[model samples]
Target: MDIIVTIFSTIIDQLQKPTLAFLIGGMLLASLGSKLEVPEPVYKFIVMLLLLKVGLGAGISVRDANLTELLVPAAGAAIVGVLIVLLGSRTLARWKGVSKIDGLATAGLFGAVSASTLAAGMAVLDDENIAYEGFIGALYPFMDIAALVTAIVMAKVSVARRASNAEIAADGTMAMNAAPKTEPAQIEGLEKGLVKTILVDTFRSPAISALLIGLAIGIFAAPDSVYDSFYEPLFRGLLSILMLIMGMEAWARLSELRKVAHAYILYGIAAPLVHGMLGFGVGLIAHHLTGFSAGGVVLLSIMAASSSDISGPPTMRGALPEANPSAYVGTSTGLGTPVAILSIPLFMALAAAFIG
Candidate 1:
């Protein structure tokens, strides 16, 4: 019993640490709409720095990590990404009764991994002195792309299916709400082009580009003085500043969140836990099967818990413009990421309990 208390206490103590406190403080101030602001360019720079640090850290550690051993977790990350979209979208549309487009959009937002959330998870791992394989950071792109592609494709399919079922009117024309009648060739060409464009854009995204570059550097390059100066000396300080900025951005949507339906709001809070537990469960299984460490399992769980606030909304907007941005953005940024941040320690605790 004492040991259990000690474990939770340690987790709580970590959450309350001063660095995370800036996140809390930023939220408080931003929710009030205070004048304090992180300039747009400065925020971008900070984000870039954090992402590079993560990549570099992964790079350094990855040399010692057996690339072949990462296959299970990497595959698991992709599977979990798809699951989050499928399950999350269905639950929203069927259970909460949101419109199909809105439900699918929300699913995409949650289904995708949040880069900021990943950054926070890394910070937590650093704070706890937990050691995980550097290649784990490489898993970010797999989850990110999977979630975005799943959401976009599923949303398109749902719209098409609904259109196909529409009854023909007495005048021998399609129903107004049905997809506009078009030649099969035109439709096929349009769909093909759109899908190609989305695929291209998703891959070309800046975050994905940065992550890939970092992975290449980490994997191919030998250790150098630059690694120590860039990643070790400066990572956390920049990350703290980044968290403060994210806190502001998140709370900026406070009003939008207040307007969400109670059912949707509950989904926002609960979905992360469900996804997080699922992620952690997979990580645990992989650990046993593949000999992955506890810290790696915990890190995977954290990745699963996050939503794709950065890349998700824009992609959903382009693909499903009819979907409500308020629901997806408010739910992802306002409720989901914050919850993921808070839940990461609990996940770490779970990993420790199971793997220790």
Candidate 2:
């Protein structure tokens, strides 16, 4: 009972922070049919600045981090990413009225990291005076790339298998006789440049590119003065606007989500909590092994809970063209992102409760 009270109190306190308050306020405005809307170009610029800030900070930290400290948690993050998608494949993919393609696409998004959400998590932790490793931001690409590549590969394989089965059912004798000749070619074609495509697309995506550029500049050049004087001060104000835009967007996507199967609505609501706990569990193991900090664990949970709002959708659209955008995009932007943001304090509270 005491534990529950502590968790609830932490959540309440965290929600009152400006970063979160702006989010809730935006939702309220949108719900009331307020005409407030941030221009797309301005929103994109805010995201770029935020990602660069995160990357620059992480890069500076990475300059001094021990090799082992970075590698172990990175491996853990990659594993969590793959596990989230696989877990969803078994559950969401099998739900009645949910197509396999749609489910996997949704899973891929959930598994992928959210740049805005990561920034938000960092902001909240900063506000609460929680100390975390700087290299935590560096782990984003490993998890993001792994989850995306895994999901797209799985979806392509599933589609290929279904196609082969269909051919056999249509003409069993011909398909069986030609199976040895045709199957290998089909497999080879699926494997050919599929990963390359996903990789190129992901790296070139606006958010990831901004982050990578920031990381590069931080590592290879001396940006400390500018970073501290310029980016640092601007971070919170920009994040508040970003959160407001996200809140309005989340509310706007609700109608699209409502059009999809009810299972998706449920999944969107529940997956963040479940996936976050999974991440927290992995972070615990890392902490015990490598002394991964309490705040790092909470951030990892935030990454897990967040669904991809920036990169995942376009990558999924290109990779799995047949999948319905309304399902994955709506569920993610509409429900998953909000739940993930709201759950930040819960994970932070859990980390304090357990790690302390």
Candidate 3:
């Protein structure tokens, strides 16, 4: 018991960032190409923890939520994030000359929420006795469901397109043995890699499994066994692994930097601006609708600020290995967080002073 508490404390401490310093350290490590190898089980554990944390936190968040008043904004932000995935995928599909599936998979990643950022918000708010992170967590499942559906639909469409298109040319791949080698070896390679990397990994994620379990428990009214002691140890261990995977993934991002083009710029600059504005809007609306103080109002930004898009490059590197997502995640985490840290207090103060 003492060990569990001690370990939990250490994990949270290790995961947090004081400022740009964590990013700088990450960048420096990237530049050095230091082989910081995390164990395979550790990676899986991280995914479990990451998803579990996301699920558990989200579960706890919406437990007593006032669905009537809060559901709208929660649904709105979640929906908007999905819409952005569709729009962003369109842009990428057009530019990258990839299948709709590929575009969807890529865009879906960006559309997904970054729990690390939200975790940071939770940390900040908890420190101050504020109550807004819960609202953001409550909205997260919508983001996951949207991403899953987008990926599934796009994957099916993309696969069908591959089967139908003459250009697909999967000559040697599961051919009818007389299709005259329709797809060349190279094209087959691309096709095989893409299918395995995007569709399979997305579908087979353990985090998703755990989340569904939590959702079932949420809806079905589980006994204390399912909620309390049942997954407690798993949850804490998962939390540590999640942060560690984040760190490991961060290392991969630094390794592959050159391939990323202007996307890095969008993540660092455009993302934060969009996040702050939307978060502030959400906060303001939340305030008007409910009587939450300014501090509570702007807590939305903390969740909005740190993005999975910032982590997009790093994330891609893990699966694709063809793209270095670090520049996006590292640079944006560096830029977005500090600004958010500074902006949050100000917004909360102003909201409280003027609005209250």
Clashing pairs in 1: 59-218
lDDT of 1: 0.77
RMSD of each candidate? 3.1, 1.1, 10.4
Candidate 1: TM-score? 0.89
Write the candidate numbers in order of decreasing TM-score.
2, 1, 3
My TM-score estimates for the predictions, one after another, are 0.89, 0.98, 0.58
Candidate 3 residue lDDT tens string, 104-143: 5455554555555454455445555655534455565455
Regions of model 1 farther than 4 Å from truth = 1-7, 167-195
TM-score of candidate 3 on Cα atoms, chains taken together: 0.58
Identify the candidate with maximal lDDT.
2
lDDT, residue 162, model 2:
81
Number of clashes recorded per candidate: 1, 0, 10
Give one digit per residue, the lDDT tens place, for model 2 in 1-356: 87799999999998899988988988899999999978999999999999999999988888889898889889999999999999999999999999999999999999999999999999999988899999888989988988999999999988987887777678866865766666667778999988898999999998889988888888788889999999999999999999999999999998897778999999999999999999999999999999999999999999999999998999999899999999999999999999999999999989989997
lDDT of 1 by residue, 127-155 (tens): 77898777788888777778778887777
Give the Å shift of residue 46 in candidate 2: 0.3
TM-score winner, 1 or 2: 2
| Candidate 3: residue 91 lDDT (0-100) | 64
